[model samples]
Target: MSTVGRPPGRGTDEPVGDLVSRASQQISALVREEMRLARAEMTQKGKRFGMGGGLFGGAGLIGFLAAQASAAAVIAALALLLPVWASALITAALLAAVAAAMAAAGRRQVAEAGTPAPQQAIDSVKADVTEIKEATHR
Candidate 1:
């Protein structure tokens, strides 16, 4: 029966230079793959952040319209008992206070989004480096 593959060049023992070159190529490929993975992870997180922010903006727009209608109604009703300007001022002050509170809460939510760094990729790279060092030393 004929052998299936090409005959092996040099039996078992590979040259030091050839071994080092192969190791270098492998390490380079591994680093590239890790970087690609990290980019993908960060991109996913960024999309979520963007989506949340967009939703918040849409909600703010709708809320603004609702508040405007409500404030006008309140001012008109209050104006029946008090001066028009006074009713308007009171309504404005209440709306301003609510806006301030909402702003603070939104800021906290955004801040909680945290850093987008690829922590898993970083740790994996660190472990790979350590393993390479140990192998090289041996």
Candidate 2:
């Protein structure tokens, strides 16, 4: 009942079309798994970045409080040499200038940090796509 040259797949067991369909399904599953892996990797990096930023913010807050206390001490010392109001105003002005400079520097640094997308994952996915396209073309 089997053909002379062509395999019995067309008549028995799984046909060639079914095998092709299965291969496609497996490829799709592989792609989904790769996506999941990429997502997990990105999430891990995001968490680490968030934690670092939070720690920096907390340290900055503590430093600000310390600086305020130090400014008060400096003003009190200066008051012994000049009128209290003049000493306080001078201290306040100096502190304000320093704070402004620091704020500008911080802003510039943050702007330079740029976006936090998963670039490696994106590149890998792009390579995979290119490979798939080449294979399909062949």
Candidate 3:
């Protein structure tokens, strides 16, 4: 079929080679456009994530300062009834106890977590392989 001088249309008879070439080019263009769109979206999301992370860091610093102020207030309150050195020592002891308790709890949690390997997935894959082998034998 001749497609010469005919404007491209669905009804126009065209060579198979020309149609395949056009389809290939269209697919390539479509993929490139999709990649470009994905890159742009990721870039925008990355910027937002960075800004959010920075804000969270700032908030964390402020929270740390607040905690320090609170600790100082506790020491000052104790100092009203006791000597300054004694009050500071008591505060330090209390903080140390809290730290020890937290560390112990963290260690317990880590122990409870067991190994980091994906045991369930490994077992599932093993089961699948066994099933496949059994089927092949059958």
Candidate 4:
């Protein structure tokens, strides 16, 4: 009973050692592929997190500038109660509002990006394990 055309372990003539070796090799390949997928997924999520963090940094810088402008506005208002100080105050307020909005957006982005875990890869690995177990039982 030549089993050259059939899959491994399916042939009655093949040695048990050969079947085990093939199964181990296939399992190793599957694990490597799953690990690669996990790494890629993590890298993508990391990029999203980096972008969100950058937005937060930008918001902080803007907030600092608004604070400086507010200080200048207060000084102008105290030194000379003119329309210029009022305009400065308005500008500072607008900047501060913009910073707040940016910060909120960044927070939302980070939240939506989710945890750094490779959820898809985990699910795939779990499914693969289930399939292998079922196959072994059969």
lDDT of 1 by residue, 23-90 (tens): 99999999999999999999999999999999999999999999789889999999999999999999
Model 4 lDDT tens row, 1-138? 677988776757679998899999999999999999999999999999999999999999999999788778675765575577666767678778998999999999999999989999999999999999999999
Q: Kindly report the root-mean-square deviation of model 4 from the true structure over all alpha carbons.
A: 12.8
The reply for model 4, stretches above 4 Å from the true place, is: 1-9, 81-138
For all candidates, what are the clash counts?
0, 0, 0, 0
Q: For each candidate, what is the lDDT?
A: 0.91, 0.92, 0.94, 0.88
How far is 48's C-alpha from truth in model 2 (Å)? Answer: 1.4
TM-score of each: 0.51, 0.54, 0.84, 0.50
Q: What residue pairs clash in candidate 1, if any at all?
A: none
Q: Judging by TM-score, tell me the better candidate of 3 and 4.
A: 3
TM for candidate 2 is 0.54
Superposed model 2: Cα runs more than 4 Å off: 1-14, 96-138
lDDT winner: 3
After aligning candidate 3 to the native by TM-score, how far in Å is the CA of 54 from where it should be? 0.9
lDDT string for model 2 (59-134, tens) is 9999999988998999999999999999999998997898899999999998888667877899999999999999
Q: What are the per-residue Cα lDDT tens digits for candidate 3 across 1-138?
A: 776777667555568888899999999999999999999999999999999999999999999999899889999999999998999999999999999999999999999998899989999999999999999999
Candidate 1 lDDT score relative to the true structure: 0.91
